[model samples]
Every structure is written in structure tokens, then in C-alpha cells.
Target chain A: MSGFLDILYFIVPISIAYAAPLIFTAIGGVFSERSGVINIGLEGLMVMGAFVGIVFNLFFVDTFGDWTPWVSILVAMLVSAIFSLMHAVASISFRADQVVSGVAINLLGIAIALFSVKMIYGKGQTDFIQEKIPRFNIPFLQDIPVIGPMFFKSVYGSSILAVAIAILAWFIIFKTPFGLRLRSVGEHPMAADTMGIKVNRIRYIAVIISGGLAGMGGAVYAQTMTNDFGHATINGQGFMALAAMIFGKWHPIGAMGAALFFGFAQALAISSSGIPFMQNVPSVFLYILPYALTIIALAGFIGKANGPKALGDPYIKGSR
Target chain B: MSNRLINVLVPVISIILGLLVGAVVMLVSGYDPIAGYIALWNGIFGDSYAIGETIRQISPYILAGLAVAFAFRTGLFNIGVEGQLIVGWFAAAYVGMAFELPKIIHLPLALLAAAAAGAIWGLIPGLLKATLKVHEVIVTIMMNYIALHLVNALIKVVAKGGFKTDKIQDTASLRSDFLSELTDFSTLHYGIFVALFMVFIMWFILERMKLGYELKSVGFNENAAQYAGMSVKKNIVMAMVISGAFAGLGGAMEALGTFGNMSTRAGFTGIGFDGIAVALLGANTPLGVVFGASLFGSLKYGANNMPNAANIPIEIVSIVIALIIFFVACGYIIRVGLQRIGKNKEAK
Candidate 1:
């Protein structure tokens, strides 16, 4: 019992910290995918967000002081949302292949961000920011028994915010009238169109919201984990989030759960050295666990993942 | 204009627009676009050495492009091309290092090993897509990460915990001393011939074979193909395997021709991702992929000179490449714009 508790105390906080970014990003994916647009550009949007977040934090640390990370996240969100408009214009307005457009967006995001970094810093990477997101235990919550030590200690505020947002996303996606209209557009745009729900407009909103949330996720990752942005900073995290979204079957709460599972896998990989039996295990196995599990989950071990009926098909106003 | 003319015109116009946007970006960044283009040109065609190296770089790209184009022709997206290439690279290097035989047997054996490795990687996702109805995109994406980690681990085991494996024996090398001498000591090799041959092979399979017809029918309409007594699952798996074999051969070009060894990568080589752009620019055609590969290969090879010659970052080339793909993706807009231009010409 004591050994299990010790492991929990060691692993839980790290898992939550890792999961926070994935939760935000996966929820972002849920929003876009649920609206019938496959936003594979989430990776690119995250890259943009991470780049802007680090740049903003580095430049404005003197101005914003302790609030620098938060402010940078907001700015990153706005910039990333605007950046995602290119994807929207290409795929939605111009009727480009969504997957191809997303691929272009990924390449463009990394290229433009890295180019700007070199131009500004006169180097391949930027200076690390001093003001990182703070970690603290909730005052009263820390007094609770076994749970407090495992869950409340050294917790990032972003993790709590992520969980809150997931719940809020769940409410907004499933309970609201707007949610019904969004699903209707994704499921049967023609029916939704007849009922006067401006399908394209709803899709545009969903994509923008996804961008904003994914940007926030990127910013949070840069601030809390990496504390700097480089080419490798947001590597594959966006794809992992995509996996989480899929594993969760495109549901908000389910995505959060999947994110947590992936986060646990990541945490185990990082913290395996501390555990006795795991010390001898190959690190590569741990590294491959989350991805391998995703494949398994999608391979009908869990259940069939049926996406929106109209998913990946562009709506052409009146065309069948 | 004829439909065929419009099809060619769209890609051409997109390329021009892409370059124009790149020039505008250079101007915005306070750099000389003319000097950049000049440096870019010199980098690719300044001398025999540059030309040789550029073609060497293009060899793998041609195969990668073909890999993607073949899959696209079969209604599949093999995003795991990078992962397949990695495993193929390792397999070729391993076979090359482990063997001691005549050149003919050794080289073919190494190349076959690479193709098999890549095929297995692709087959897993294909099987899942066919049997379990899992989305290939997601499975391929996962497979990529798995391949990276698994290959890296295997490399360590082979190299005794080092980052790279031992260099392959001379018998298996694709490098040609005669070609290198002709190209002013550039790393040009026999891989270019192999790449071109594979291009022809892909064309033959897709255009002249019954299997190709079956695959195309499956891609075009799975239900219709099934109704017509085709095995949709088998075609899907076969298409992925063939696509993977092409990608794997791309890895052999790097292993046997250019590098002669396999090393653990810090990230993806970007070759497979760039293959997406190449396929798109090529309009997913065999001959078109050759043109796309040449353009992309030269630009990529040329990007090295931009930082020194124009005081610009090399990433600008990547930006240009990305923009080109973006324009290609938005071909509908270009078609509309061209139609408008044609109408204006008529009015005048």
C-alpha cells in the first residue's frame, strides 16, 4: 500500500502536467472534427502558438512580470486563430483537399515560425523565458488525506484549467442548442441548411475555436514544460493529441480521458528510472507505449470509432 | 482551354504564384529576392559538382514522390512513408554490413531487404485498415512514431549503443566511382537509375496492368468494385505494400548511395512529408512526379546557399515549398482566376 502510494505521488502530478497540454489540444481537435473538418493542421497551429508564446514571453517579461506566461498564451491564441484562417480559406472557401491543405499549413507554420525566429534572434533558436508557469498546491485541498498528496501537491494551475475547460467543452458540445446545430452540420449539412443553420459559418466558428484552444495548449506546454520554443519543442505532441481525440471517439470528456492515459504513458517513460522493476526495462518500449496503445485502441480492441457521417467531405452549398 | 491544358496550367500557375509570394516575403523581410534566386540557381547548376549533387538529392525524392503518388492513386495516404524509409534504411544498412557476396547478389539483397522492411511497416496499417476498418491516416501516423523509436532502439543494439551502424561493404554500395569522377567528385551514384526505373515501374503497374485496374476501381468506388467481384481488402493491402516498397527503395538510395550508413534520427528526415508536396505538385502522376521532384530537389539543394549568398535564412526555401503546396491545394481558386483572365482577354 505504501509503495503504491509513493508511486502514485511521484507519477500523478507529472501525468497531469503532461496531460494538460494534450487535453487542451485534443479538445481543440474534437471541436474541429466534430464540425466535419479534419484539422490535421492542429500540429501546425500548435507550432505557431508555441513560437509566438515563447517570443511574446521573452520580449514582454519586463512588462508583464509574473503575468507574462498568461499574457503570452492569450496573444498566441489570437495569432494561431488568425493563422488557422488560411486553412479555413483554402479548405472551406476554395474547396481544397482538407488533408492536403492541413499538410501545407503544417509546413508553412513551422517554416514561417523558424524563419521569423532566425530573423529576430539572429540564430536558430530563441532565448529561454525566465517566467514559467507556477506550480502550487491548493491551500485547503492539500490538507486532505491520501488524495491530497497524490493529486494536489505541486500541481500546475494550467492542469486544473484544462480539466475545467474539458467539462465546459462537454457542456457546450452536447447540451447547448449551438452544439446541436454544429453536430447537425457535421452529420447532415443539407438538413441543417434547410433548417437555416448556416453550415459554413458554424464550421468556420468551430475551426477558429479549435485553433484558439490548440494555441492555448501549445502556449501552456511552452511555458510549463519546455520553457522555450524550438523546432523540437512541440514535436509530435499535436499528433498525440490527434490520437487522443480519436481514442476518445471525438468526445470532449472521452478525449480528456484519452489524454490522461497518454500522459500517464509519457510520465512513466520519463520517471521509470525511479521505479525498481522498471529500471531494467528498455526506454524505447516505454517511449513506444502510447503510440502502440493508440493503434490497438483503434484496431477494434476498444470499439469501432465512427466519425461524423459527413466528415472529410466538403459541403458545396446546393450540390448533392 | 481544353481540360488537359487547364490541368497543366493550374500547377504551372501555382508554381509562379508560389515564387511570387516568396519574392514578396523576401522584400518584406528586407532582403534582395533577385540575389536569393541567383544564389539558388547557382547552387543547383553552377558546376558539374552541383548538378551531380542535385540529382543525387533528387533520386530519393523521385522514389518518395512515387511512393505517395501510387498510394494516392489507390485512395490511400501513406503518411508512414518516413517511418517506412527509416526502417528500410536500417534494413539496407544491416544487410549490406552483414553480407559478403558478389556485387550483383549483395546489392540486390540489400535493396530487397529495405523493400521488405518498408512493406511490413506499411502492411500492418493496411491490414488494420482492411480488416478492422481503422483509419489509415491515424494508423500510419502511429506507425511513424513506432518506427522511429523501434528503429532507434534496433540501431543502438546493432551499433553497440552508438548512434550509427558500421558503414556497409563496397559490394552493396550504389556509389559509382566513374559517375563521381565525371561529376567533379560529387556523391552521385547509380541510385538515380534505380529511381528512374522505379518511376517507370510505377507507371507500368498503374497504366498497363490488370492489378492496377482493380486497385483504381477499388479506389474509385469500393462498393462498385465489390459488386464487380473484386476483393477490396486485398487491393488495399497490395496498394499499401507496393507503395511501401517504393518508399523503402527511397531509403536504400540514401543508405547505399549517399550516406552508406544508417544513423538514429533526432526527428523525421522531412523527406516523407515533403513527398506529400511532391505528389501534390505532380498532380499524383508518374511523369509529373519526376518534374515535381526535379523542381523540389533543385530548390532544396539550392537552399543551402541562400544563407551565405543573400544573408537570408534557409527556412525561406521551406516557406516557399509550403506556399507552393498551398497554392496547389487551392487549385480551384487558380482555375477560377484563370477563367477570369481568359474572359478579360476575350473582352479586350
Candidate 2:
């Protein structure tokens, strides 16, 4: 029984912490992809967010006190949303190939961030932040017999916020009129345009929203996990979130599930040394498991994970 | 203006604009743009040593650019070039270390091993795309991480838990003593010949072969290709295989010429990612890729001098490259701006 409790204590917080960032980012991917703009630049946008978040926290830790991380996250989201305008202007207004533009975004994002870091800090990376987002147990839920200890104990506020946002995202995407317009534009922009809906406007908003959420996700990860910003802080997490977005078939709740699964895989890989039975297994196997599993999941096990019909196609004014 | 002139003009304009923006960024950050540019120029062509090293650095970029350009020409995006390159690096290193043969046999055998490894890596996503209708982009992205971790593990195993493998035997090396002597002992090697040959091969296949027609048609439209009695799946797989081989040869360039050994990477080397920009700047053409690779290689190699000479970060080059890609993607804007300028000049 103690062994089970020990495993729970080890696995629960780690997995949730890992999953929270992905959940936010994957849901962001869903919004953009569903609105017909392929956002391969999420990684770049996340990098910008992580950079901004760390810079803000380091500069204003005393002023914001305990609220530093949260404020930094908000600042990151705003900055990233503005940064994504470059992608929207290129891909949407200029009718650029979305993927190419996205690739440029990724490159520009990292280049600008690192260049600024070097200029400001006189180094490759920033100083570690003293304050981080705090984690705590729920008031009454931690007292429950078995479930409480596994789920509610030692939980990050950001983790809970991520799950709550996922639910809210589901409602927004599936239930709201704005969601209907967004999906319609993604499915058939021509049809949406005929219905008097502004296709480019919707796509711009969607991309901005995606940028904001991904930025928030990056900040959360930086503040809670790394406690600082560097080149490696947000490495490939955006891509993993992208995989989760696809693996979840672009559904918000489904993306959350996939993120949690990937998070579990990541947590297992990181914590394998502590587990007695799994100690003999090669770390490589654990490391590659999530990626290999994503490939397997995509190759017919999921039965055609079709994206929005017009996902990569830019909507022109009149040309079919 | 002639179509060919316009084609040349667009890239030239983009490059100039990219550099201008980079200059502006430097100025905004309180750095001397003139000094930075001067430092950059000196770094690239200061002496024979810098020239030789820059050319050597360009060799792999040429192949990596070809890999991306070939895929783009065939309507595929092989984002897995990084993964293919990784596996190829391992394969070449493995053969070079484990085998004993004459120089001629050893070098080609190592190159072939690298190509085969990259081909296999590319084949997985191609097969999945053809058979299961899975998107190649996500699959290739996944393959990258798989290759990174898998190769790292394999390196540890082969090196007895060390980060790098033993250096290759002399027989397998691409080092050219005469070239090195001419360039003041720079790391220039015979890999440039291999890169040039592959460029020619890409040109011949894409522009002069029947198979190229099929591949291009398949890329243009799978349904149309299928209707024309061509096997879409076969062409897709074949395109990826050929592209992967080019990328793998890029890895061999590093293993056999530049580094002479493979080490576990903390993260991606950014060579493959940079290949995307190279391909774009080159307009996805064979000869264009060479020029693009040269420009990129020069900038990247010269960037090392920025810290000491001008107090600028090496990432400034990356920013310039990114801006170039952005301008290329938004060529419509440039074209419109140019046309407006032309009209205004006529009125004046």
C-alpha cells in the first residue's frame, strides 16, 4: 500500500506538471488549425513567450512579489499575440504559403529572442528567477481516502488552470456562435465568405489566440519547471503539443487527454531511475516511447485523423 | 523585364532588404551596423584560411539544401532531414570506424551506408503517408526526436557509455592534404566534390529524366498522376528516398570531412532547419541552392567573429536569414512595391 502511495506521489505531480504546458499549447493548436491556418510556428511563439516571461519576472520580481509569474505569463501572452501578427500578415494578407511563413516565424522568433537575451544579459541565457509559481494541495480534497492523494495533493495552480481552460476551450469551440463561425471558416472559407463571415478576420483572430495560449503555456512551463529562460527551456515541447493536437483530432478535450498521455510518458522517462523495477530498462527506450507511440497512433490506429478541410489553404477573395 | 531577370531580381531584392533590416535591428540595439558588416566581411574573406573553412562549411549545407529543394520540387516537405542526417552520421561513423578497406572502397562504402540509413528513415514516413494517409510533417517531426534519442543511445552503446565514437580511419577520411596546405591547414576536404556531383545528379534527374516527370506530376497532383497511369505511392516513396539520400550525404560530409567523428548532440545542430531557409532562398532549384548555401555558409561562419570584432551576437545572422525567408514567402508584397516604384519613377 505504501509502495502504491509512493508511486502515486512520484508520478502524479510530475505528469500533471508536464501535461499542463502541453494542454495549453495543444488547445492553442486546435484553435489555429481549426481556423484553417497551419501553425508550425507554435514552437517559435512559445520561445518568445518563455523569453518574455523570464525577462519580466527577473526585472519585476520585487514589484509583483508572489504575483510575478502570473503577471509575466500575461505579458508573455500579449507579446506573443502581437508577434504572431507577422505570421498572419504574411500568410493571410500577402497570400504566402502558410507553412513557409510558419517556418520563418520559428526562425525569426528564436533569433530575435536569443539576440535580445545576449544584448540584455551579456550572456547566452538569463539569470534564474527567485520566485516561481507555487504549488499547493486542495483545501478539502487532499483528505479523501485514495483518490485525493493521487489527484489533488501537491498540485500546481497552473495545472488546475490548464484543465479548467481546456474545459472552457471545449465550450468555446463546440457550443458558442463564435466557435461555429470559426469552424465554418476553416471547413469552407468560400462558403463562410458567402455567408458574410470575414474569413481573414477570423483566421487572424484565431492565430492571435493560438499565439497567446502558446505563449501562456511557455511561460507556465518556464516559471514552474525551468524557473528561468534558455535555449533549451521550451525545446520541442511545442512540437509535442502539436502532435497532441493532431492525436486528439483537433478537439480541445481530446487534446488534453493526449497531452496528459504524453506528459505521463515524459514523466516516466524522467523518473525511471527512481523506480526499482524499471531501473534496468534503457533510458533511450523511455525517451523514444512517446514519439514512437505518436507515429503508431497516426498510422491507421486512429483511423484517419483528418484536419479541417481547408486547413493549409489560404482564403483568397474570389478565386477557387 | 525578362522572366529570368525577375526571378533573379526578387531574391536579390529580398537579400538586400534582409540585410537592411538586420542593420536596423543592430542600430536599434546601439551597435554599429557599419562595423558589424565590416567584421562580417572580414570574417568571410579575411584570408585563405577563412575562405577554405567557409567553403568546407558550405559543403554539407549544399546537400542539405538539395534535400529540401528536391522534396519541395516533388511537393513534399521532409522536415525529418535532421533525423535522417543524424542516422546517416551514425551510419557513416559506424562503417568508417568498424571497417578496414582501401581508401576508394572505404570512403564510398561509408557514404553508401549513410545514404541507406537516411533513405530508410525517409521511407518510414513516405510509406505511412502513402499507405495510411498520415500527414508527413507530424510523422517526420516525431521521427526527429526518435532519431536523436535513438542515436544518442546507440552512440553510448558503441562508445561504452561515452558521448562520442572513435574517429574514423585515415582510409575513410575526406581530408585533402594539398587543399589544406593551400588554405593554411584549414579543414577543407574532398567532400566538396561529392556535394557538387550530387547537385549535378539532382539537376539531371529533375530536368532530364522520365522519372523526374513522374515525380513532379505526382507532386503537382496525386489524382492527376494516378489518372495518368503513374503510381502515386511509388513516386512519393521514391521522392522521399532520393531526398533522404541527399540529406544523408550531408551527414557523411560532416562525419568524413568536417568533424571526422559523431558526438551526442544536446539539441539539434540547426543544419537541417537552416536547409529550409537555403531551399527557399534558392527558389528550390539546384544551382540556386548552391548560391544560397554559399551565402548562408558565409554568414554563419563569419558570425563567429561578431562577438570579438563588433560585440554582436551570432544570432543576428539567423535573424537575417529568417527575414530573408519571410520576404521570399511574401514575394507578392515585394513585387507590388517594386511595381509601384517603377510607376512612380516613370511619372517623375
Candidate 3:
């Protein structure tokens, strides 16, 4: 029984590592959609963040040493925010189709990132980072019983950070005055605008924040999940975060829970060989599990789980 | 300018702006823009072989673009075109290799199988949207990954050889020796004609049929369409099914004509994603997709030769393609800007 428990313990910490990025990105999605901007560019934004984060780490690690990954995380957020301004300008200012603008951002982000990689390294991939963000065991928490070893013995700081951010996000979104204005704009842009809220400006800020957070999510995925940056490093994680956002009913704390669930699913896929019952199962089924679950969850819960009222609509000053 | 003329100018202007962005990237990167452009042009159009290759590359893109455009016209986003295309590619390869029949029967059968596979894949998201009110965008994106992993697994189970299947039977192939000879041994095939035929089919359905009007009406205003006694849900499903058919044919073009073999993939083909840009550039019209696909194909095919000849990374071409879509997505802004300029000139 302890042996079985041991395997579970091993998988728990690894799963949290996978959950970190999803939590951050889902929170990002929540922020954007709550303000009426549907940021389908989350995937692309994640790619930009991952690429810049890894590139920054590779080039600047000598100067910053152990502080390199954290600095790179900040840089990635700024870069991704700047990059997402294109979508903001197109969707909010120019009144271009939001979905179309998002698709364009997705394309441009990956393309520019890969192009720059080639220009800098004369190759399509960035150099692998030698040092990663440090992980730790909680000093007092690890001293407890069965729960302690499974939860706190070996924990990634990034996962802890994701949970903290999700809580902070929930507080900001549900309990703050700014959140009230943001939700008002998403619910009724005309009413919000008439009542002195700057609808477009609020949308721009929300989208920019989404991009920055998504960039950090991507950076965490790179720094913790993978050591190198390439075109494939951030694949599907952003989309999965969107799935988590939807599954969570657009709530930050709920999104973190969904992310944890997905991260567990991923961990099972990766660590199935060590688990007794899962050894004979084909890995393909494991691979398809999360996506299939997302589809089912969306189909099952969407009718009850309403999104922001003006989610995909641009705020026209005179429009009904 | 007339609305039609302004509509026509959007893509043309965006293409120029996209190219200018490419030039800036090139200049900043310290490569000679003139030499790079010349190499790209020569690679695409300077020779018969190059032109043939370009056309060969474009045939699938046209079909993929049509897939995206058709759905766009019906107010549906078909991000799963990549998934549909891959499943279709696998189905075509499977039927081509697994069957024994005359050339006349075998070829069309494989293509039909591909179309069916793609249609079934597309139908799921369509049904989800109609029945559950789940957003098709989210469903399609999820379905793409599901299709990718499931098909990769299925291929491993079905294929006799290692990672790739055997060469497709000649009777099941789309390659035409006559065209290959005409194009100086390029891989150009009968797929081009089929692609043109599909364009006509899309045009006929959208322009001449009552069903087309219904689809467009639903796209323009679903509530209004429902008020007019049309089944909005059915039209939505039908549009996705039809859009998927186009993507299936594109996969057949690649499997039967270009590659003639299927290999396992760990990632998406990206042809479907590129199709989004093509559809946008083409203004969601069948005829426009042809021009859009042509430019996209020529740039992509031409870029393959640039790394060796011009010392420019091929990713620069992707940047250009992406920028084109970006500028084109911002087409409304450009249109308003243009109209303002025209008014200023009129005042002068």
C-alpha cells in the first residue's frame, strides 16, 4: 500500500508543474473574456512568451545567474503584452473582426518568434537553459503524515505561484471596484460607456493584462516543463488553458481547479508505466483523454455556464 | 471608389503592405531585399518547372482555403480543417493501399472515403454547436488535437510498414504522367483540374442554389433566418459538412497527388491554419481563394529555395504571410482610411 502511495506521491508534484501554466493562462483568459474581448490568441501569446523567455534565459543567464529565469519571465510578459497590442488596436480601435484579428495574432506570433530565433541563433531552436527555476520542499509542511509527503515533500515554486496568482485574480475580479467596471463593460458596453466607464480603454487594459499573464504562463511552461524553446514547446497548452477557463465557468479559482484536473490527466499519461493498472493501456488513449473530456465538458455545461454578454462584440459608441 | 472596387483593393493593398513588412524585416536583418525578392520570384515563376511546382503546391491550398471560406460565409469557424484534412489524408492513403480495383473505380472511391472521413469529423462539432450551444471554435480546436492523436494511433495500427504506409496503388493515385512530362518532370498532377472543379462546385452552390441563399442568410443574421422559417441549426451543420468536404478533397490532393504516402505526425499540418489567412485574403469567395492560394503557395514554395540561394531563413516568408493576414484582418481600418483619403482628394 505504501508502494502504491509512493507512486501517487511521485506523480502529484509533477502534475502540479504541468498545472502551473494552465492556471496562469486560464486566469488570463478569464480576465480578457470578463472584459468582453475574446482572446483566441492565447495560444499564440503563449508561444511568444515561451520563445522570448527561453531566449532571454539563454542570453542573459550569465549576468543574472539564478535570477535569470525570473527576469526572463518579466521580459516575456512585456514582450507578449506589446505583441498583443496589435490585436487590441485591430479589434478595439480599428473595429476589425475580433476572431479574425486573434487568428492573425496567432499566426504572427509564432512566425515572428521562429524568424527571430533563426536570425539570432542561425537555427530554428533556442539554446537550452542550463539552470531552471528552483523547486523546494516546504520545511514544516513536509513533517506531517500521509498527506504531507504527497502534497509538500517536493513542490515546484511556480505551481505555488500559480495558485497565489489565481487567488489574487479572484479577489481582483470578484471583490474589487475595477472588476465591477470591467464586468459592466462586458455585460452592457453602451450602459457602461454612458455611465462614464471607458469601454474601449477598459477592454484594451484587460486584453493587455491577459497577454502579459499568458506570457508568464508560457514562460513558466518553458522554465519548468521544458528546458528548451522551439516551435513545439508551447503546443496545445494555451488551447488547453482556454478549455480550463470554459470548464471553470469563467471563474479564476474554478479555473485553477480545472487546470489541476487537466494537469493530473497529463501526469497520468506520462507516468502510467509506474502505475499497476495503467501499464497495459495504450498511450494514445491517455493522450486523447484531456481533449475528449474538454469537448464533453463544454457540451455538457455550456448551456448553464454563460459567458460575458458582449464577449465577442466590439463596443460601438452609438450601437444598441 | 465604389464599394466593390474598395473590396477588391483590400487584398491587393494588404499584399503590398505585407511585402513591405517583409522588406523591413529583411533590411533590418542585413539581407539585401532586392536579391531575396528576385530569388523568391525566380523560384516561383522564372521557369516552367518552377511554375508547375508552384501550381502543384497551390492546388491543395485552394481547396483548404475554400474549406475555411465556406464555413466563414456560414458564420462558422472551421479551425478543425487541419484535423479534417489529416483524417482525410489518412483515409485516402488507407483506401488507396487497401483496395484492389480498376483505375476508374479505385481513384474516386479513395477520394470519397477521404471526404466521408473529414465530413464525419466536422459533423461532431457542428452537432455540438446545434444541440448543446457549445462554441464551435472551442470544439474545433479541441477536435484538431483529438483527431491528430487518434489518427496517429490508428495509422500505427493499420499500417504494415514502420512509421509510414506503403506507396499508394497507381490506380488510386492522382498523379498524371502527362502533366509531369509537360512540366519538365515536376510533381504537377491532375489535382489542379480537380481543384478548379471544386471552385466551380463551391461557386455554383453558393451563387445559383437556394441552399446557398439559406446558408448566407443564416450567416448574416441567424435570428432573422430562423424567423424566415429556415432551420438555422441544420444550415450550420450542413455548412460545416460541406466545408469539411473541401478540406477532404485537399487532403486527397496531397495524399493521392503530392505525397502518395502517409506518415505519422506528432503535430498539425498547418495547411488548415494557413487556409484561414487565404480565406481572409480571398474575401471568403471561391474565385478569390484561387488568387489567395496562388500567392500563398508561390511564397511558400519559393521560400523553400531561399535558404540555400539567398542565405535568408525560410521563416521570413511565414512572417510575410502572417503580416498579410494581420493587415487584411485590419482591412476595415484600411478601407476607412482609404475613403477618408479619397474624400480629402475630392475636397482638394
Pitting candidate 1 against candidate 2, the one with the higher DockQ is: 1
Return the clash pairs for model 1, or none.
none
**B58-127: candidate 2 lDDT, tens digit per residue:** 9989988999899888789988888898898889998998899999899999999999999999999999
lDDT (tens digit, per residue) of candidate 3 on B1-348: 678988999899999999998999999999988888988998899788998999999998998999999999999999989999998999999999999999999999999998898898889999989888888988898888898888888888887437888889999999988899898999999999988999999999999999999999999999999999999999999999999988988899888999998898967888898999899999899999999999999999998878877888888899899889889989988999889988898899
lDDT tens digits, residue span A81-162, model 1 = 9988888888878889898898898899899999999999999889989999888888988889999987888898889899
Every model's TM-score on chain B: 0.97, 0.96, 0.98
The ten-residue window of minimal lDDT in model 2 chain B covers B1-10
The DockQ-based order of candidates, best leading, equals: 1, 2, 3
Residue range with the least summed lDDT across 10 consecutive positions in model 3 chain A: A297-306
* Candidates' chain A TM-scores: 0.97, 0.97, 0.96
Candidate 2 accuracy as lDDT: 0.90
Model 3 regions lying over 4 Å from their true place:
A301-303
> How well does each candidate reproduce the native contacts, as fnat?
0.89, 0.89, 0.80
Error of 2 at A318 (Å): 1.2
Q: What residue pairs are clashing in model 3?
A: none
Query: Clash number for every model?
Result: 0, 0, 0
List TM-score per model, in order: 0.98, 0.98, 0.97
